[model samples]
Target: MPRTEVPPVLVTGATGRVGRVVVDLLMDAGVPVRAVTHRSEAAATLPADVEVVTGDLTVPESLDAGLRGAGAVFLVWTVPPATAPAVVERLAVSTRRVVFLSSPHRTPHPFFRQPNPMAVLHADIERLIAAAGLETTVIRPGMFASNAMFWWATAIRADGVVRWPYGAAETAPVDERDVAAVAALALCQDEHAGGDYVLTGPESLSQAEQVSIIGDVVGRRIAFEELSPDEFRRETEGSWPRPVVDMLLAAWGATMGRPAFVTSTVLDVLGSAPRSFRQFVADHATVFIDPTPSR
Candidate 1:
């Protein structure tokens, strides 16, 4: 297949957290962007300069339209039926490069050895992208800093206590913005072709340490209380998907006695240190604040 002549980059999952950030970074770099959302309603948030398209990966015809006239594509499999040969084939024939947002599978640590169905699906996509002859960049990010917001923001906002299992478990949480920047760089430049980048934050910190950082950023005294494994499971029983909950608990349990691996890839690629957990909380402090303060 010939190169796509730098028409525009197609960003699937454009309305999602990392995708929106990627779109912004690409636009900042003056690269024309074609943003693809699953529904027309989701397109409203995209900037007016972006060309928004409604596309679904489950249906091949839907993806073909979005794949047209694009130099490269950022593939993020957010929906189910994770193995889609037609979608990969369409991208292979229509585009020059593909950057996949994937997870770590072959990490030497036992924590990453937890059985995760998502990893299986991402591996399948990586194989298909390689076999299809498209230049591929596979990015495997460690635990996301945003996960803290989802896990503890509510409790901290309400009662100043972050309740969770394995508070001593360590992780090097990567910022979503850093991940987006790397993805945009891979999409717009050829230097990262056929590269498998393992992205992580600068330092390894325990869960309790992360909570304290957030508290410092938010200007409040928040406490971290370790929950029993069974209690934690019960708390998230109906709130999260069964497989995801199981995988997280298993990973956290395995990490209890070990330290998380840290890397400087963000600094190497973006020429700056990855944003610390405190910075993330400071940037998003308003999200944890109640609009109507209770007396």
Candidate 2:
């Protein structure tokens, strides 16, 4: 008998942080991958074996080429929620399974219970998937460890002091690679259909402690200076979006007195411990270190 051929898995947001990793994992597992990107030039960064197609989530019709003959889809929704219904409808007709990258908003933890537009978007997409009757698995990851690089890398590189709010607030920062691995597993295996997994890191660490860990990795002393929420808002008024700043402030304020919500879903799904915050920092130390400094 001839060998069975696996249908390609379509990956949206193929150039994104988590989606890029998912594409690599699927390719490494000998699974065919079809990556959808808005910019044609972005496809050049993906592995040579991937079938890259141009698609925009906002315009649902653009996804037809990428969705054709795909068995499963890894959906990463970062765009606005205007065209989600049409997109979900298209996916229902095009693919058999979908793995959605979501947040742990449904978790009974104060950190995740804040007023978040992103959570609202995720919930709405989940409902859309359920109504469309597509085989789906939702991967909810809490506080990505890579957020440290986005939140503090520039400040750490500029000076040894990180001026930020909620230094005492604790969170278990899940590794993006772990999230991508679980997503890849769900996309490839039929057993994960309808599975909902909330992924977190191995341990909880406060904002200050996380900064200290980065300092340890860089072999220097970095100071954590807590800022008032209003001060933070003023500092980021022009540069950051108003809603995002408010969302972070609300979450941090709500979880100030409590430990972060931690889960073993990564270990349960991948059969290995989730990467620690220190490990994440150690691996990306160059981002936090400046090469040239004035005396």
Candidate 2: C-alpha lDDT: 0.94
Which candidate number has the best lDDT?
2
Q: Deviation in angstroms for 194 in model 1?
A: 0.9
Q: Model 2 over residues 7-86: C-alpha lDDT tens digits? A: 99999988998999999999999999989899988978998878899999999999998899999999999999999999
Residue-by-residue lDDT tens digits, candidate 1, 179-222: 99999999988999988888887788999999998888778888
Poorest stretch of ten by lDDT in candidate 2: 286-295
TM-score, prediction 1: 0.95
Give the C-alpha miss distance for residue 8 in model 1, angstroms: 0.5
Q: Considering summed lDDT, which 10 consecutive residues are worst modelled in model 1?
A: 78-87
Can you tell me which runs of candidate 1 are displaced by over 4 Å? 1-5
